[model samples]
Target: MTNSPDILSNTFPDTPQRRLLLDFVADEADALQRGEQGGFWPDNHHLISPLIGKAGKFLDEDEHVAFFHHLLRLDHCPPVKTEEDFALLLRAYDGLGDLMSRGYPVCSLPFHLAVFLFGGDALARLPAEPEPTLASFQSGVSFLRYARSFAHMPGIMSKRQKFIDLSADRALVARVRKTLLHGHQQLLDGLGRLWLWAFVFLVLQVEEEAQPVIRKIREDAAAAGDVKRVETLERFIAAAGLAR
Candidate 1:
């Protein structure tokens, strides 16, 4: 999770974009060294804090990094507190978003993650989504402004089903909600699971496919008599508005 040059070089193969990302990461790490930024924190991922040194690039690699690492394959990042912090993180993600689109052109998770991180209202107030502020990104991200983005990248196309649930992501959320539950569950970290869960319940807001999966997990917990787990699931379901 540390922002060592090694992690950057190893993550990106392209020398050009790699340099851009490395520079961005270095700036972020330096920002962390300077001081704290300010803002309201969301309950989810409202958890990470400023680190001591060049650690993990700025913030530690938390459960959220799992998705960024495994799917986009670099697999990592975190949230911000103030407008400055939000802009700093947003700038890095902009590099990530553009870096990711170097080959492909239509991915939107970078923009979506930005909105999710800064809160929809903050993004809404902007003149426009500053997502790929890079000139190379010809396509502005889909913000639900036009359509949903499937991310149409490696994880979905990996040969071995690298991320089982993620491998099912065919760039279509509805299709994902329809088919993802059928895939066998694997070792997604807590945030990974939370992201996938939220992807279904919150984004699609449909109960058809999500209900069965929720039932299966709840059933498994009940069968094992894991009272804590069952309670946790109920609380999550209720809070996420998963249950009707």
Candidate 2:
């Protein structure tokens, strides 16, 4: 295949590539259920392995498609402007997040997810919105709840990760498993906080320009008696401001 697997390029993640990513997501899940010894994530160090396996490493077609395609989907993201025709970029974002939660190597995506989900002109249509719909506010709160699980999720110990994580730290990532399982609550909490800081940060990318949207989401959570959500959103607002 001439495709280099580098996302955000003119030559990658065309419709077929996008479909391939989605298909392999399901395939990984199914592969886990039946219990393949190593599952499909490449034994290679990177989350997405290279097309031609070097030395003695090997990559199956499904493993190559699912993981690399995921990166492609992530790079293009909920389609914005003259960016490749990724009209489904936000949906693509969600798919990428789902994959991360499943322990695919995320490299720096967590950081990108936290800070740049709507980078550039991705949200170009929203600057003049009259008001967020009830649905929009609800989705905001829901996303925080969805992302919160990773705060403490070890996301480790996969047979797949043990091989890779051992090097990366899932096998230790498998090793990480050994540490976390034996470690105390304080360690878990600290780890959770870092992951949450990254994971849920995307729950609300509340830059000052985006504060109105965050305010509405916070307001809705408050009115609905969601003390936890109200407090969290307030913190996100403060954190966003501080980061500046």
Candidate 3:
């Protein structure tokens, strides 16, 4: 991600709200596609960070938090040109969630992938199924883990069931888990890097237009000894004409 203008924006066309939904979708898809092809896509991931920063800014200052809230929710999908496409994506996510909740097997793999990548609200409704493909299986495990963590994040007060051994398909879960635990670290790292790149762009831009919240992020990062956020903070400060 090179902080290119091509990746900027905060809303999908046709949606009621202004969100960088397309940029987000593009980044996530880049991660997965890169994982499949044995690499990373910096440009794809770089496209969304400013939007994330914008969402953060709006969340801090805008009275209409719903729009920004929705923007933050778009981490699941890669970028799309229109909200109509996003609506289809939403349906797939909801359908997949319902399928997972019913304890169906790998037949619902596409839906699972769609939901996790697209940030549709209905993922919690899906039943767990162990898809056989290398990508799907690994993604399934990661999805559950992330979902569990997301459930615990601030402002996400959903009562979805945590992923436990359902006993219905322990063998599959165990098999996929073993595989993912062994060689999937790169994928995770790539995803994190993608997000980091975007965050860098966000912090750099937002601090100039919206300072207070970015300052708070810096302070919190300092208190927590969160070295990883340093790059983002630096970019923001520099961009804001504050200091590196």
Q: Write candidate 3's Cα lDDT for 139-201 as tens digits.
A: 444544444343221212122122222213444333322322222122232223332222223
In candidate 2, what are the lDDT values of residues 87-179, reduced to their tens digit? 233333433443333332332233223222332112222222323233432333343334444423233111222222223311111112222
Q: Who is ahead in TM-score, 2 or 3?
A: 2
TM-score of 1: 0.29
Residue 209 lDDT, candidate 1, scale 0-100: 46
- The superposed Cα distance between candidate 1 and the true structure at residue 155, in angstroms, equals 29
For model 2, what is the error of residue 57's alpha carbon versus the real structure, in angstroms, after optimal superposition?
15
Task: Please give the clash total of every predicted structure, in order.
Answer: 9, 20, 22
The per-residue C-alpha lDDT of model 1 at residue 133 equals 28
Tens digits of lDDT, candidate 1, 1-244: 2343443334335453334344344443333234321121122122222231122343334312321322221233432333433344444443343333322222223323333333222213222223322221212222222223334222222212222343243333433333333322321112233334444333224445457656765665566666765564565555545544
| Ten-residue stretch with the least lDDT total in model 1 | 37-46
Q: Which portions of model 2 show Cα errors greater than 4 Å?
A: 1-38, 42-67, 70-208, 236-244
Q: Point out the higher-scoring one by lDDT: 1 or 3.
A: 1
For model 2, what is the error of residue 187's alpha carbon versus the real structure, in angstroms, after optimal superposition?
A: 27
Which one wins by lDDT: 1 or 2?
1
RMSD (Å) of each candidate, 1 decimal:
16.9, 16.6, 20.2
Residue pairs whose backbone atoms clash in candidate 1: 1-56, 2-56, 3-57, 38-81, 38-82, 68-75, 69-74, 69-75, 150-171
After TM-score superposition, what is the CA distance of residue 170 in candidate 2 from its true location, in Å?
A: 37
List candidate 1 segments past 4 Å from native.
Answer: 1-71, 76-173, 176-182, 187-193, 223-225, 236-244
